[model samples]
Target: MIQFKNLTLRRGVKELILNATLTLNPGSKAGLTGANGAGKSSLFALLMGQLHADQGEALLPPHWVVAHVAQETPALAVSAIDYVLDGDRELRELEARLAEAERDNDGVAIGHLHAELARIDAWSARSRAARLLSGLGFANDAIEREVASFSGGWRMRLNLAQALMCRSDLLLLDEPTNHLDLETVLWLEDWLKGYPGTLLMISHDRDFLDSVCSHIVELANQTLTLYTGNYSQFETLRAEKLARQQGDFERQQRQIAHLESFITRFKAKATKARQAQSRIKALEKLERIAPAHVHSPFDFHFETPESLPNPLLRLDAISAGYGGKPVLDNLSLSIESGSRIGLLGVNGAGKSTLVKLLAGELAPLRGERIEAQMLKVGYFSQHQLETLREDDTPLGHMQRLAPDAREQVLRTFLGGFNFHGDAALGPVGPMSGGEKARLALALIVWTRPNLLLLDEPTNHLDLEMRHALTLALQDFAGALLVVSHDRSLLEATTDTFWLVGDGAAKPFDGDLEDYRQWRLARQAEALRPSSDDTAAPNRKEQKRQEAELRQRMSQQKKPLLARLAKLEKSIELLTTEKAGLEAFMASEEAYADDNRARLADSAKRQGEASAELERLEEEWLALQEEIEALENGYPQQ
Candidate 1:
């Protein structure tokens, strides 16, 4: 158990957590959440013994084994799995003792150490390490490579894997989802749910927190508050508490109403997914925390394009890939003004490749890519971060993007993204990844692109920025194609989904929740032990085969799935309409309005459309079942 009694913590003269008392019971999986500067990280530091409480006591049992992701990963020549195995210090020590005993010709000592190793299941340590790495999105080949060979993001995943490798009584993870794809996020969520430890994690991802956490612990207003249940539960409880305070409820209502407006506009892409509902509920919960962000430094939105061309982009029977090899074959997609699309697939399933193709970074090898002459594309990806000039400031970057824009106007826009004062003018080399990400996004928004090809744009973004991005995406009158792992972002912003698996970009007939189930099923099939007793596939062997199998199955049922997707899209519109009307009715203004004619008409239409939507949805589901059954059929053995 971890307990803090009237704790007051500070960094320098700034008070972080003040006069806070909280208790986390043993084996409690708790999420620590707050604004980026709201002392969440500082509290983790206190728990890790890197910081001291200024008053009272912060206590944990002395015998508790703590595991936390290292902020800095050492560049080592050791194999990544071996480096992860090193996280199990006891296992490493026992192995070392065993080696020494063998060298000394001490048979008795060697026997005892070997038995100890078996007790700890040391023989399968590599396999366990590989699973952790794989669950975090590392490929099997990457697992055996030297640690120093990976890039910063990949290295961060290794660090997370190392932390998970340790068998401990307490586990602390900070933003473990940042470097992950949707596939890995699902895998990690399942793993965390089964972890037998007192877990404390700092994450901006609301969906991840809700999935992994049993309790929500928020640090704000120099206080630590604990609530029962997950992030959604916490928001409800917090909203209720805040609703009683003067100005708090009003502030929350304003923000919620604003969010509801965007959500309504983008409902067609977001309504079917439960995660989007979670966000809507979360935003309604934001009605409780309005005071916290009343003056949030970040308040930027994308500018509407000067020209929104109909059918902003069109691809006809395209074959796209890298180095002359096709990753997407005979793939065709049309992007029109107001298209809100999300791409879903396994890793290396060509999600990014599709984005690159849309951005014209990769030319189609066999198909025609027709772009509207007025199409101004704003492309964002993790790789774009590397393209930013390290020596330039955020303002400098924006100036270069729009040379004709006024300096004061550009500075004001940068300030909206929280790049103000010296920070706005400082060199990018010293900026944090989050800061760099914000700058890259700022530049892209400055371009007023009518078509956006964003690949994992939320990778290094904080909750606030993610929220802003979601809102901006909703308001932008543009064609959007996004590849992201954030469920909240996907559910909130995208209206349609495209599967980038099997080297073909086709409309997917499901939502984010469905995608999670699909991914998990695929992973389970790939990982299941073979029935043949004599020749079981090794973990690495299974992963390699899994990738290949997904690739092989990518092109199957393209036509049927695409048609089903079209039908589902119609259902999406109906569902979105009903959901939006209900959302409006949930507001106080609907009941007021000086008159009730609009409310009556809305209620009448809602009743009319509800049954129609159900019929369309049912038809869509039956079609999906037929396609699935067909895909599953095979010749008798």
Candidate 2:
């Protein structure tokens, strides 16, 4: 458990978080969210003791172990398993000490060593380490692979696995899902949901947060505001709060205007002078709540040209692969103007290969590929940042891309994508992945291409940024082809699904969720028991029973829907109660009543509310899964 009391953090003269008080209870899962550079990672660093607060205290339980996985990974060349196993450094040291004691044949030291070994063994450290490593996507073979050979993305996963292996009482993860593939991310979600340790993570993965976290802590305007429920619920509540604040501000403005008018009219009147003065004083003393500033004013507007009637790119009977191995064999696909297609597949399912083929970066083997005349294609590769000059500043890059543009205009453009002042002047090499992605996007928008090809465009973006990009794509008139694992982004941005599997490309008439459900069902079937026992029913009978179960699952949806609704209501109520309690606790007046009895009462209520919220959330998630299964049974409209 950890607590931050009256904490204030600043960079130079700019305050990041001010007067922030928050508690991370045992087994609590909290999400830190806000716009980019709102100090989400800074808050994590503050908790990790990597950065000290300018004021107040970060309190931790005595001897509580804490581990943090930062956004940027540290350089290491050790094997993945070796790196993860290093998390138990303390236990390793104890083991070494015990070995030395045994060699020395010292009775007292050996006795102490035996007890220490017992204590270390009591935690079942080895089993935990193995489980954590496996859960994070490190297989037996990958565990031995040198980390230096892995890509930056895989290295980040290695870092996460290492952090999780620590088995610390408190874990602080910054963008833990940034590099994870869909399956690994889901595995992590399950792990975190069932984890008994306290967790505070900064993640843009909505599904991950919705599955794992019960509380949302936002860093804004140099302060921390805690919200109940996950990211979606937080968004709903935040919008409502902002609306209420705006209304209150307008009402106050009207009251102040009337008071000013009265004061002006009654200044010389003896009878009304005192009342008018009193009203003036009250108006002057009123604390005006300023409207929240929009983080960036640069609207993202994609100017897509009118769709061409002809097909831009076509692949017929194609076989694509890497290093002499086939990934997609005998595949046929066509891309025409006005098509917004989403590629859905597992990590190694040839989706990226398919994109490369469409981009003309890879030549198809034993097939015909064609490109329409005057095809101006803008390809946003997964490694698009590699196109950027590491030594060049964002502004410099922009200016070079559009040399005729004025300096002020260039700076304004960069700022619109969240690169402001000195930030725009910083080298691209040092920028975060999200910043680089935004810069890449800004550059691409400048080119104004008619055919856009993107691979994982939402990789490093926050929810708002992702949504903004989705909107821009939705409005674009160009033929768009995107390969991404982000379900929501794909569903909202694309009109059709291009599934790259079974050694070919096939068109599916639905969103990514449809693809996901199809995959899940296939996986579930694959995991189902195979006929073996003599007493078991015949294969056809078994198939009939499975079909019946599927039918029953599809038909028995009403009770689950009702249960889902009830759970939603419970979640809403618990969220409201938690928010009220937090607001009350943050008030100065509440400190005056900080006696044992009052504190105990508040703590009891908080605990109850938290427990109830967690339970309801779990039930809600299960109901959602059931609904997803049922929805998969219906034909796509």
Q: Which candidate is the best by lDDT?
A: 1
* Residue 326 displacement (Å), model 2: 4.8
- Residue-level lDDT of model 2, residues 442-522, one tens digit each, is 998877777889987887777877877877888988899987656667777788887777687788866545655776687
Q: Which ranges of candidate 1 are over 4 A from the true structure?
A: 53-55, 72-77, 102-127, 138-152, 247-297, 316-319, 323-325, 363-368, 386-415, 419-429, 527-637
- Give the 10-residue window scoring lowest on summed lDDT in candidate 1: 628-637
Cα-based TM-score, every candidate: 0.70, 0.72
What value does the lDDT take at residue 204 in candidate 1?
A: 81
The CA-based lDDT of model 1 is what?
A: 0.78
How much lDDT does candidate 2 score?
A: 0.72
What is the alpha-carbon RMSD of candidate 2 to the true structure?
Answer: 16.4
